[model samples]
Target: MRVPVSSKIGVSNPYRSWKSATDPSPGNYSMGVDPNGGQQIVIWGKEGRRWRSGQWNLQFFIGIPYMSNNVSSFHGFKISLPDETGTMYITYKPPTQDLFRFVISWEGKERQLKWDDDKKKWLPLQSEPDPDNKCELYNYCGNYATCDRSNSRRICNCLEGFKPKFKDQWDQENWSAGCERKIQLQCQSTNRTSRENGKPDGFKKLKCTKLPDLATLLPSEENTEACGKRCLENCQCKAYAFVTGIRCMVWTGDLIDMQHFQQFQQAGNFLFFYRLHHSELDGGRKISNLVIVIICVVVASFLVASLWLLWRYKKKVKVSSMPCCKDKDVAIFDVSKSKRKEFSADLSGPSDILIDENQDNGPELPIFNFGVVAAATKNFYEGNKLGQGGFGAVYKGELPGGKEIAVKRLSGNSGQGLEEFKTEIILIARLQHRNLVRLLGCSIQGEEKLLIYEYMPNKSLDNLLFDATKKAELGWRSRLDIIEGIARGLLYLHRDSRLRIIHRDLKASNILLDAEMNPKISDFGMARMFQGNQNEANTVRVVGTYGYMSPEYAMEGLFSVKSDVYSFGVLLLEIVSGQRNTTFRSSDHTSLLSYAWRLWSEDKAMDLVDPSIRDTCSPNEVLKCIHIGMLCVQDSAVHRPTMAAVVLLLESETPTLPMPTKPTYTFLRSAIEEEYIGDAQEIVSSNDLTVTLQY
Candidate 1:
């Protein structure tokens, strides 16, 4: 339902939730636009202020780091400035969405839940005051301090240039007194900052942390650098943060309810600058990370030198002592004669991928130098950026031989770590398939890691499949070809390959398209390999997109070949309908799977075909594909057909297909669908324009 939210003084109609799921009565919590100030939503509890949906900086609330990168922008949230009557309103209207509502949970957790028609339940979408994150509570850490849930010992810690006001209480686990300044500011003292060559007070830079509350927008300072100057001139300004889509915000009053959230995607990161005395800032200069890197290098070099010298000295002494044995006909044997070996290179990109003993497994993956890659991509210019994800950006480049390549660069702040980088190179190098994306090589220089792949001119399938106009280019034949290619590719990985592999992340975006529009499965970072007859494996860490993940994999961390089949089914239905399975909803169905099943069971499977495809697609083939998709998405893993069988059915029309049972898709069993809602949890939908089309 599209409802109007206003912050008018007299007629503000806020959505105050019930006491619990079962109890439908006025509760102690409420949620609505911030009537006090700013374009934000506030969740109020009985104790007064609870949590806030950080200021809306045109893109998304600064409160949610994930939203800082436009992760929530696709949800179609729009807010209008105060009108002539001094009233503002915000609305939620995605082009295609289901019935959803806002509610303050019994525990004062502001939640956004979507209605699931099939299950007759409300699926949670967004929530504030995350019960798991204790720092979300209003002013929990007090003023001048930050909370870090990741810190196992203590949640609250004083910011730099400050110390706990009451040391006795603080040691006893009480930080209620907050913190006190360690040194007087330049403006606060008659003889200020004598300790650091009379340097002025400076700001301590903090990255990817929640900016404190009660920020006053500074429209005068347009440039971020100018914003810092403006803050320095003002004695009242305690902290400052520059939000991309919004004006610079300076906190003049006490900074409250700050938190140190985990490092986010590059685009999603925001820097918070807290005021500090010059002495604490090393002679009032910006803290250089390069200095830290250099210091570590020096220490490491010293240690290496010491160890080498010690080894050489000991070897020389041993040699001098073994003079008599050397003449006694000594025989030596090589210790490096073993055939089977494993590469143990870490944080070095594709250098970890070693060649197999047998030549049939193919040559070792090529390792491109960083200089070559940087030059090819024009020094990694913004214009050359093909796309940006949690792992930095993808650049389109060309080699000296005129071969085009797609380079995936890893961001230091990215969620993709060394394990994922190694996994991609090791897994892709060992497997070979026409329908699988080829890993040309990689570049590892210093902290920079990049993976080079055969460039796909058409990019990802989602580019065409989701766009209204671009989708027209994907005719029925092209869509069918993509489907068949993906099926055969999955078949090769699951059965024909030397190692039985499961492409955990099998979504439209992961399926790349070449010049011919043929689909090749890409991105094996989250993939798992099964050894001789090992059907499945369980892990505590579950990775993959939520809508496409199988029930067992998403809930119990249990994954196998069947998990890929389930993902394949989701992709199949999406391809047929030209709609996102995650957001698609019908009058009587919660998702595309149930909707298609309902139509199939009623002998009206032809209705499920995308209108664009209906004119050109053969009725029999479309129906058969729908039948196979339903079979692949069955409730149980055993009910789904293997990739081998799926390939046979797609390739051969003569083979009779089995009748599909009713398919039931479930949401994430965990309370938090995914703790970190990075690029993985979101659909990568690129828009031609930034304008929000108001309805």
Candidate 2:
């Protein structure tokens, strides 16, 4: 195989497959990075992680014993995380090349073997050191302890300030009983009186450290001082390490796998564990004035350069302005006059798309010259389009001034007429919040009515929550943030805004995602404005995404703030489960709601959690979210708490959730159509399946 020398395939597998007719079966053993990022390579069997090579030092795999034999040779490899985006490869150029290759035995043994031409059989060059016992498995020694390899039998000894967690487990060779603190650190308020433990049992250092589990990749700017301070602040933090390239990797909770190494070549860079409160970091005094000095020097240089630039620019302008003045003035006058003529006002908020000359609003919302908008959006090109919805197509447009804004071009034939268009403009123009999307004014020239808003970079929540690849990126923390953000936005709509607004259409698609994945509630064309203590209202035109619509609103046109709550509940479940309420299907259940309810009833709600979340996500926390979601989608409007309550519940650890009754109507579309009449007056009639109110 003439593969290029430059090209490499990263293979973490410890074993190689058999190539000849003599060996008929595939290799059983494989080696790869520990999923926990413990700097350990696990030798895995068909069923489970069989044994680990303790953890790596800078030079060698720590758990495996070094060979001092003259015939034996070993080479170890280590690379910084940044260099390892591709697969790992190894090319061994030994002094003697006698048809040697790496192979994994059928029964899961890893070895390097040579072909014996005379014997016509494969001969073993090296086999894994410990042949027969489970005790050879790495980390078999409990934490704060080291396995004494000097003796025929491995002996375990505790490091300073450590003792076994379970004495019985340790005596029985169940070494994973690990180690517990000799004196517990008092983190809780009730443990304040336990001062006899000596100022929260400080850390005892191991000279040559194999860093602990789950090392979080810290930002590059973080230094030793900040890392130390961070580690000290968290009571759970067991140890902290500050390396030159790796920077900070803090370990919290248990320190599982610790081992000793002799004759360290690259044992790892310096690691610090909290032994006791050492003298506070003195590096702050050294770093303070350096940044200020740099800023001052840069500012002085900029100011001096700016004066010279201004003088040159003035001379250039003086030469250019004379000839162009008359031509520019005439052009300006004509353009100004045309602009003045184009400036017409209408009561229906500023129209960027169409100009209503009769109405009295400034220039009828500054309708974009179609040519300018066309050029900006590359002739309404598909590439420039942000997304499309029931109202119209939203395009990503760059103005003449190079300012980017999202232009929502309302569909002319959309079910929502000019009334809804005007309402959105008026409502958005009057409202301003960091959480809410900012309305950057509108355009109305002739038929085109374009409303402009700040462009959110991440598109919409639907793109993320429902996408398999994207959903993995939005882990539990991000999901929780999105949930909290939506809650805040809803709170603004319902209570904080000048008018109490009910976002009649509150689906995942309508929720825009900011660059940071923060959720911004959008699509207000269908949002109803409530005035002066109006708690509930009914609309004949029941408009919203079908799956998200509350039973009261979908079958009957009675939609209130409570209806919005129901939609939010659906959104909440979708966010947590990474499954769409509408598209989800099951053999036994009709919809996501029924499936979730069944899971909740069966006490298997955790099963609904996405499998992609391999990180530390609390099961109780997920169940609590499910409980809150169920509460929000309750059949009775009165039973559901307001957005305010939802926000509080999401934030509080122990929220007193009300017992959610079964929803009044199942999301069986066929069943709903047969039972509920599709009439404006019929919708207005309150029944067990509906809630009715007159607008």
Candidate 3:
């Protein structure tokens, strides 16, 4: 019977080396520090059979190609060697020390063992020598067949375009003879073009493989495309593949040891052969990949130019499509009577009335190619996706000049479609401010509509405040800068810009964070254009997100610039407290605003500040922001301060703010369903015009 106990060393289970056979003395094979470096593990053996396990490679054992499962999986497996006077000792940092052990059993079995929590006993994890024997050994199939570990029945097979060199030997389970080519062809015959008149012999695709070694790595100095080109140029370079992490690898020598992963572990490379002419390779359809590449590049360029033109066309269409609202004072131009001249010197004048109506004397906005955007975004791979929203997914991209860009691909299914796209472009093109996201260009390729904007490396403010690990980065200084920047942006929209516009949607997600953590308001898909004299409008149909909308706007579809003020107040509170307005729920409080109000009334307003930001924040500054947040979110639209006043209070050290009235944070949509108020709108025109709200 075996007795078990635990010792303290690297979090793994520790034990002393067992005694030797002849004299019952302790054995030399033990886990200890290396003489050259104290941080390595060296396995000592009798006489001179010492095997160097090598130093810790930060992630795994250096000498072993088979990475430690624990280390590779990053389950907190670490090895440490402590320096002492007598000798250095080794230890591990696993979840539990009792779970691991290195044992030199009495029967000559030297293995790293682990106490399986599920099995409840010491189990052999891995041995010094791999358990596979005979065919399982490396290069077992005589350089032709592979020994698959996952397969139920062990078998051997030759690579494509080849057959067993010695069939009798292989059938007898002695596969040393390897494989031979099925057909005998000279170098000239291999290139079908040489034999005929420039043609490909053929190609075969192999799949689910560990791949062959040495002979596969293409000679160093070759670019991926060039390497592939070189392989095709030569008859001997049979097959090739451009690996994901690794570049191109080609085979010149005889192919061997090819295996297929069961549908489960499917992982293999392709292997092509050179034995036909150009037309013969791919049913005569396979043009030289080089030619295909050239064609693709030309096509891409044409497409980019076409997309740019299409974007221009769509912009023109959007301008012409603006409907004449039933307003007595506004003069509507008759497109049918107008003579249209070409915007560009080369193109002829517009032939259609709709096209003629869009003609304007204003400067043309820049347009980008859909192909360029696609290349920048790596074809919009899921890994490059930044975030999703009502509009569409935002993808991070880098332009040719190392300029990063955020491409917003509008959704086909969005409720607010072409109107929003055109509105953002028209509004952003005419404005320039530090607090606003700059629109670089736009692309309209078929049904795909993409808007390119200055990339924000830090993403939205919501990402930081919502993440437990990242929230700390939003310190008092950064948070305050964001608040001020947002205020400046609103001030520009409300009073400083050429157009008196209202950013009807002003939540944390809409505020993009740049590399310096500076805030830039983005996603103007739902923004509204207010005439210089217009103050408020009423409608039956209403649209906007909850928690940040004013009461009248949320309930009766009555929206004014005050709606934005209320939303700004919600944003300010979220910034100060580092919490979301929508997801905020408390058993004691009805909403985030209510919670803050309760805290303020109870003389415990400091409790509302995020614990992450509390350390560096000043009590007075935070209290001031809280006070301003309450003032802006006050129930009455008349009571809320203009963005101009809000900016002043935020920047100044002294301001005697009026006490806030009870806020109408929650709007009674009806007696049945109550929607928390927030600023939201749906654009319906290209002139920064929002749609009439209709529930």
**Which candidate comes out best when scored by lDDT?**
1
For model 1, the superposed segments whose C-alpha errors exceed 4 Å read 1-344, 347-363, 667-695
All-Cα superposition RMSD per candidate: 22.8, 21.4, 22.0
The better-scoring model by lDDT among 1 and 3 is: 1
- Alpha-carbon lDDT, every model: 0.73, 0.62, 0.63
The backbone clash count of each candidate, in order, is 0, 33, 31
lDDT by residue (tens digit), candidate 3, 1-695 = 11111122321212235543333456444434433321344444454223333234345543233444334333444433433533333344555556666665432344677788887888765534454223323355656455555555546677655678877456545565777666543344655666665334555455455354333554453454665676777777766655432346677765543444443221212232323333433355656989999999999999999888766664343121114323322211211111122322212222210112443232145556566688789989889999988777999987654668899998787655776676676677667777888887777678898888888889998999878899998988689889999999999988888667778778898999876677899877667666666778775545556667777776667888899999999899999898876666566554678888888878899899999978557677889999999899888899999999999998786788889986634422221122333223221223222333344
* Minimal lDDT window, size 10, model 1: 331-340
lDDT of 1 at 472: 83
Off by over 4 Å in 2: 1-345, 349-371, 614-616, 667-695
Model 1 lDDT, full chain set? 0.73
Off-target runs (Cα >4 Å) in candidate 3 are 1-363, 665-695
Better of 1 and 2 by lDDT: 1
Model 2 residue 368 CA deviation (Å) reads 4.8
What's model 2's TM-score?
0.48
